[model samples]
Each structure stands twice: as C-alpha cells, then as structure tokens.
Target: MSMFLITCSSSFAQKNELKELEKLVKRNNTTETAALLSTVEKMLPQATDDQKAAYYFFKTKNLINLANSGVDFNENRSKAIESINHLIKFENETKSKKYTTEVTALKNTLLAELVDEAIDSNRNKDYKKSSRLFEQAYNLNATDTVYLYYAASDAVNAKDFDYAESKFKDLIKLKYNGESQTYVATSQTTGKVESFGFDRKARDLAVKSGTHTKAETIFSKSAKPDIYNNLTHILLNKQNYSEAENYALTAYNLDKDNVNSLLNVLFLYYNTNRLDRFEEHAKKGIERFPQNEILLYNLAIINMQNNQNEQAKEYLSKILLLNKNHFDALKSLGNIELQKDADITNKINALPNTTTSNKKRNDLMQEKRLVYTTTLDYYKKAQAINPKDESLNELITQIQDFLKNN
Candidate 1:
C-alpha cells in the first residue's frame, strides 16, 4: 500500500509539471507568459531539494532568453530576480555545497546588467524609468555607495524632492568615508602637484543649488512651453511678476489654448489691478473654458466693476445655471437686481400716471427683496461650509441686518 501511494503521488506531480510546461510553451508570444512562469514556479515546492538548484538555473536561462527576445526589461528583471533568489535559497539549504558558484555568478551578472541599464537610462534623461532599475541594483549590492548617490541625483533632476532626500539621507547613514586615491605633492623633483579629489564636490554643489536656473535658462533660450511654464512658476514665487508674465506670455504664444498660462496672466493682471488687461485675458480664458467657475466669476466681477451690468448678469446667470449653489454669482445677481430696482423706481416715480407708478414700484421692490433674501441664504450656507471665509460671513451678517431693518 505504501509503494502504491508513492507511485500515485509521483504520477500526479509529473502530470502537473507537464501541464505547466505545456502552458508555458503555448503562451510563448502572449502577455500570459509571466503568468505561465508563475505557474511553473509553484511546481518547485514538489521538486527534490537537489533538483531545485538546477530548476532555478533553467528558469533563469529561460527568462534571460525571453528578455533578449524583446520582453520588457522591467518585467524580465523581476523574473530574473525571482530565479536568482530561488537558486540562492536552494544553495543555502545544501550548506552552499551545490550551485554556490553558479548562484554567485548569476547574481553578479544580473547586478551588472541592472546597473548598466540604470546608468544608460539616467544618461538618457529618463529619470522615472531609471529609478526602479537603480533601486534594484542598489539592493543587490548595498556596498556601492555611488549607486545611491547617482540615484539621488537622478531623483533631484526629476523634480522628485522627497525621493531624492530619502536616498541622500541613506548615503549619509552608510558612513562612506570618501574615496581614497594616490596623490603626488609638489616638490623640487616633482614637476607639479597631482591630486585626485573624489569628494563629489561638483555633484554636491549641483544638488545643493536646488535652483531650477538651468531649466529657466533653457526655457529662455529655446522657448519650450514646459520650461516656460516652470520658469513662470519660479519667477512668480520670487515676485518677479514682470518676468513671470513674460514667461507665461511665451507659453501662451506657443500654445494659444494653454489654460495654465492664460490663468496665470489673468491672476497677474487681477493682482496688479490692471483692469484692461484683466478683462482682455479673462475674456480669452472664458472663451477657452466657458464652464470654468473661476473664469466666469472673474469676468462677472470685472464687468460689474466696470458698470457693464448686463454682461455681468449674463456671466453670473451662466455660473448659476451650471452650479445653482454658486454663492458669488447669486450675490452678484442680487446686486444687479437691486440696481435694476432702483432704476425702475426712479423712472416710475417720475412718470405722470400715479396708479401704475405705485404698482410698478411695489412689484419691483418685492422682487428686489426676494433676490436679497435668496442671496443672504446662499452666503450663509457658504459661510457655514467655510468658516474662514470672512467676506461671505460679513455679507451674510450685513444682509441679515438689512432684512431686520426693512
């Protein structure tokens, strides 16, 4: 009975292995190749302790071939790491007696490949793509402090400050006591002083500067929209409003529909109280993004201030149509109605017909009161949602006091 049970177990395991291999081969050119590889990996648990090492070797070779055949490096790298880890585990199980040299060689080869790919990608300015590869290489060999430094530099170049700071702090913790080199001091016999300074002073300076000056310079010289956008942000932060406006203008000139630059110019003109420029930019921005609440609000405010009451009403009405809860638009609309009411009252009082005059005046005033009440309610709701909004709270208080008096 024991012999029969052993035979049945071995047959089942062999069938499973054969099924996995068949699946792998059938999935040769599909995205399921990785899934197939995982299925084969599960079969390793049933492998004899000695056969595990050879199995991992075969798996590594197969993955390498797949990678060479144009599978993605990023995906293949993960598979290769899995195979190497399995081989290492099996070698350790055998007390490093079997496949120790092979496992070490494979690890070294994969590490070198990862480092080379990372360096190549970094040099090509593909920072996001290189970051994962560099991390893998660093993990394989933590002794190489240079990899961490390079990774940190790349992160900084990519504008990922948090990642860069983490990597640099890790290097500092490594306590790398600077690189050593032979130096020949100046002497009467020696022609000149020769020293190798590997303090990474240049790299440190580049990182320490932390200014996107180079990016700005490139923007100024090449007129690239992305660089111009970045420069605009930097100049805006520095309060160089004129330069920021110029950069934003350049970006807008390159791409007329660039909402970012358009909005920047709009805010710039608004802050400087350049009403004419604000109106011009606000109109353009509104045309580009008609449904934008900010654009509509800005345009409405400008129109109201300029006494373009009808146009202001149009914009406010559009905003209210889009968002019935738009408190600003509601308030502006109420103000416009109040102004209309005053105008109607004055005209009605001047008319000769006393009966029609009184009727029109009462109707207009009632309409004005209703609008005022609606505006007050909206302002109160907005203030409740954002207690820090003093303007809304003040308006609500003023309207409530006015309603109490009248």
Candidate 2:
C-alpha cells in the first residue's frame, strides 16, 4: 500500500510540473520554456503518454518562438515539425483535447514560414532547397495543395527528374484542378510587350487582401498540358523517343495553340523518322509563324527531303528575303543548283564524239557553264556569311577548277 501511494504521488507531481510548463507556454516565457524542455525530455521513459505529449507540445512551441527570434531556423523548424507531429498523434489517440487550438494556430504559423522560405529560395534559383521546404510544408498541412504543386515544380526546375515525375503522376491521380491564369501579352496595337492595364492594381489589391485575386500569372495549376510537355522533354532528353512522342502528342491534344508542344511533336516526329507527321507539323508551324526564320528554314529542308526542288527553292528564297545572310539556306540553294548542273554534265557526256562541236552540244555546254557559275556565286555568298567552314572552302576549290576548265 505504501509503494502504491509512492507511485501515485510521483505521477501527481509530474502532472503538476507539466501544469507549470503549460503556464509558461501561456505567458510566452520563451527563455524558461526553452530551459525546461531538456529536463522534461529526460523524463520521457518515466512519464505517462499525456505528460510526454505535453512535453513535446511545449518543446515544439518553444522552438518555434526561438526560430522567430532568428536562431537556427532550419534546425528549429525541423524539430518543431517532428515534435508537433508526435504531440498531435498522442493527443488524438488519447482524446486529451490538449492545446488543440494553439496547436492548430502554431501549425499554420510554421506552414506560413515554410511557404515564405520556399518562395524566397525559388526566387534565388535554389530550387533544390525550395523543393525541400515546400514538400515539408505540404506534409505538415495536407489541405494546401499549392505547396505540393510547388514542391513538384521546383523539383523539375532543379532537374530532379525522377522525383518530379512521381509527383506529377500523383497530381494526375488526384485530378487536381486549377483556375484560369492571366498573362502578360504583347499589345498587337502598340507592338510592345506589357501586362494588361488592370494587372498592377489587381495584384496590389490581392496583396493587400491576402488573397490570390485576379491578376496576371503563369504556371497556374491547370497543369495537365504543361505536365505532359515537361514529361515529354524529360523523355526526349533521355532519348526515350517512343514515350516522348506519345506525351508530346498528348500535350498537343490538350492545347493546340501551345507552340512549345507543337515544336516538341515536330522534333519527335522528325527524329523518329515519321516523315509524314514531320511534314504535317512543319507546314502547320509555318502557317502559325510565317516570319519565324528557323521554321522557314526547316520547311525548306522538308521540301528538299521530298525532292520537291521548286518548292524547296521557294522556301529558301523566302528565308533570304527575311535575312539575306542565312548561311545554311544559301548553302542549300547552292547545293540544288549543283545537283541540276550535274544533270547537264551527264547529258554532255551522253552525246556522240562528233556531236561535241554541234550547236546543240555548244548550247548544252553553255547552260552547264551558267549553272556552275550560279552554284559558285551562291556558295561564295554563304562563305562570306561565315568564313570558318572548311567544307565551303573545299567546295570553292572544286568550283574554281570547274570554272577554269569550262
């Protein structure tokens, strides 16, 4: 009976000590709370689970205050998360209803700090660190889907492809939905890139109101199209062409006007030797961006591959009109002329020996000479555009020899 009384007395004393700690928490006594946490932790084995939960609860609160005071924030943040999680689990299982309101408020405060830190880190391009903070915040507060999305996006920015892919797939599984995004656009009238007129005022109002009210934004969650495109880019980088093409097509189907998706599909089709599909996209790209020099140049190559010399010449001429010093287009034009000149040489060779001096033979030779001259002229212009190509120098050497003999 004496031993039983002693055990009861010890338990009662421990509860009183926890009550004192609770008073310190209520009074916001950071220094005293911090000093007592270590002593409470040492009693964990002897303490009841309720006492243990209270101990962790105070420890978490104390450390969070310390974090706000500019102490080792990362260390304190990590410990606070660990202790709070345990505290909540114990409180819930025991149905103690202990510190529930304060706990909820405390958790939200931690989450806000974590989100702020994540944004700062991402702004500084420390994507790896940003991803970690956001993922931590997401785990702490499961309801805020935004944190999870930021974690995945920053993972992609960091090039942690495996993690990003997993999170993106999870996003799909969740059927995550998002609102429309306003974006800065070039004014067709002014020909100047700028945000819409109301964006600044709207953004300021949102900031003042602490809400995501209507304002210009990018990378908003309606993410299926972007997610597929990003997956396609990852697969393409890994040379997984089959999967890349599938994902690229999915992205295109999601948003037809997405130029980036179109470009990815075009590249995938061309690389995978789907010439018909490649031709289709190339033509579409030209229709969409008629003034885009690279697209125009690519269309020329498509025509050249199909042996439509006249069409190829027309495309190349359009490029020259846009930028006369387009070296590759000029070189390709020279190549087509050389190919025609080769046919003339073959016709001359097919003639009988006696026909060499005839008017017909002379006329054919004259046309062949003019073709050679044109090839040399175009090639020389291309060489002038970029003087470093040794292949061009070699071609010039051959052209000079042909001109001297002819």
Candidate 3:
C-alpha cells in the first residue's frame, strides 16, 4: 500500500509538470521550454503514451526553433528530425494521425531550409560544409539521390576523398542513373522556347492553356558513367589497380559510344601492361575516330614494340599522311630502316675469305648501302620536322661519313 501511494504521487507530479511544459511549448517560450524539457525527460519512463507523444511533439518544435535561432543549428536540426521520426513511428504503430500532418509540413520546411543553406554553402565555396548539408538533405529525402550525388561531389572538391568514396558507392548501390527529363515548349507570349525541368505535368498544363507550343521531352545524360569513372579515378590514385580496372571497365561498357570513356579504359589497360586489351581498344578507337592522332600513335608504338615492323610502318605511314610533320613517326621509320644494317653486317662477317665469299660480301655490302641510304632519307625528314634538334645533325654527319667511307 505504501509503494503504490508513492508511485501514484510521482505520477501525479509528472502530470502537472507535463501540463506546464505543454503551456510553455504552446507559448513558444524556447528558453523555459528547453529547461522544462530536461525535467520532463527524467519523468518520461513513468509517462503514458499520450504524454510521450506530446513530449516528442513539443521537443521537435523546440529543437527546430533553436536550430532556426542558430543555436547549434546542425545538432538541433538533427535532434528535431530524430524527435519527429520517433513521433511518426509511434503514430504509425498506434494507427493515430495526431501530429503526423503537422510534422510532415515541418519536415518539408526543414528540408527547404537545409537545401537553401546547402546552396549558399556551395556558392561560398565552403565545400565541406556544403557536403554535410547536402548529406543532411539526402537523409531527409532519400528519394532524391541527386542530393547525395551533390554531397559526394562537394566532398571531392573539399578533398575529403574517403567520404566522397563512400557516398559514391552508395549511389552505385542505389543504381542512381541521375538522368532527368526536361519538358520544353515555345512560349506563345514571348515567342521563345522554355524548359520546365522534370515537371511534365506543369509543362502539359501550360501547353493545355495555350501559353506554349511545340512541346518536347528530352533526357539528360546518365550520371552513372561519370560515377563509375570517378570511382575508378580515386582507386587509381590509391594505386589499387585491380579495382580501378574493374570500375574503368564498367564505365567503358556502360558508355561505349563515348570516346572519353573508351580512352579511360584504354589508359588503365595500357598502364597496367594489359597490351592485348589496349591493342584491341586502340583499334576500335581508330575505327571510331579515324583521324585521332593519339590512337594512331599508340597503335604505331604498339606494333613497333611487338617487332611487327610492317604493321608498325603501316600505322606510322597513316600518321604521316594525316600530319606530314609528325616527328616521332619520321624518326621511328628511320630507326626501323637502320635496324636492318646489323643483320646484314652479321651475315657479311660470317662469310669465308675466298672468291665466292668476297662476291657475296660485296652483294651484302651493296644491300647495307641501300639500307643506310633509306635510313638517311627518313632521318633527314625527321630533322626537317625538328630543325632545333642538334642530335639529328650529329646523326646525319655520322651517316654521311659511313656512306662516303664505304
């Protein structure tokens, strides 16, 4: 009987405090409400569901007010969101609508505030703060993955790469394409075309009202490729080659028509010594961009490295056809012709000191002369392309001496 009386007395006192708190909350008395909320928290364990509901509602309102007043704004905003979520969960489980409608509007207000601040932060180039705000916005509206993307992009600008990577991974997991459709129409009043971004209903209504004409829907490019490319770039910076290759390939496959995407994959494969893949893509790139100097030069170099002299010459010849002043191609052709001298010299040295051997040696010597002449011609062309290269002069003098002495 004594314990029951003590419990009843405590409950009665808690009920009186709740009434005072509700009054302070209703009056918009922030300071007193905050002070009273602290007291109410301790009494919460003994409070009934209705009392708890009222406390959550009041707490959310107070925190939002404090946030607006710039009193630990981020913390207060987060706390307010937490409180509202709790109220929503309770309302959901009990099949009650009390506070739900009001809290939803409050959430939208909070969202708008966060978005405006985030834009301001971005405009001020406070990238880290902007990233945080965008992340908060995303937490409020998880359906808007663009906010998450903005968060990741700002984190990148701030060089907060770890956070950027995590957010980018979240986008990939969500399969966020980030493609938006725009409804466009020529405004009848202004005689100009206008774009209604991702608001087809508004565009349709305007068209129906005869304020616009020639309605068309267009889609922006998907951001998935860029996301994969960014992930690959970060991984490459960390020298995690295997994982970088995975993401690079993903980007390449997703946007096969994009030459930049193909180049990114080609670059990774080339750097990783995946020559076969590089060659394959280089050929494809050449087919796509027949006049692409980089692809043509890369193919030439690849063929040269593999000792496919004829194929290398073919590619180098094409490069010269596109750009006759191609110094590297001209020098490369000279070097290829020069390499024949060593083999011919070896065969001449292997001959016996006899009549037949001398005749054969003379024939080989003539062949060597033809090779040197051809090499000199190419070297001269290269020198003409780069007249400032004194090394080319030295090479030309050496070849002249050899031809005169022989």
Model 2 residue 359 lDDT?
76
Candidate 3 stretches greater than 4 Å from native = 1-19, 22-31, 184-186, 191-197, 290-406
Candidate 2, residues 21-86: lDDT per residue as tens digits?
888877878888877777677767778776877888888877777777778977877778877777
Q: State the TM-score for model 3.
A: 0.67
Clash counts for the predictions, in order: 0, 0, 0
> 1-406 in candidate 1: lDDT tens per residue?
9998986786577566545644654455334445545664676666566545655665675676577678786677677777777677667777654667866787899888888888889889999667767877776666666666667667767877567646655664674333444322332244444332344444334335642112111111222454455555555656778767876787778666667767667766766678788878776777789898877887788678879989998988898889887767776676665555466557656766677567776676677567568766656655655678777667777768877876
lDDT of 2: 0.80
Task: Give the Cα error of residue 62 in candidate 1, in Å.
Answer: 2.9
Deviation in angstroms for 128 in model 2? 3.4
What value does the lDDT take at residue 384 in candidate 2? 96
Best of the two (1, 3) by lDDT: 3
Residue 161 of model 1 has an lDDT of: 56
The pairs that clash in candidate 2 are none
Ranking by lDDT: 3, 2, 1
Q: Compared with the true structure, what per-residue lDDT tens digits does model 3 show for residues 1-406? A: 9999988987888788878977887787889999988988888888777777777888999998888788998899888878877888898887767678988898899889889999999999999999999998888778889999999989999989889989999999999999998899999999999999889999999999999999999988999998888887777778788878888889989987776677777778877889888879887887888886666776777677778899889888999999998998888898888889999999998998888788899999999999989999999999988878887778889999999999
Shift of residue 28 alpha carbon in model 2, Å: 12
How big is the positional error of residue 344 in model 1, measured in Å on the Cα after superposition? 47
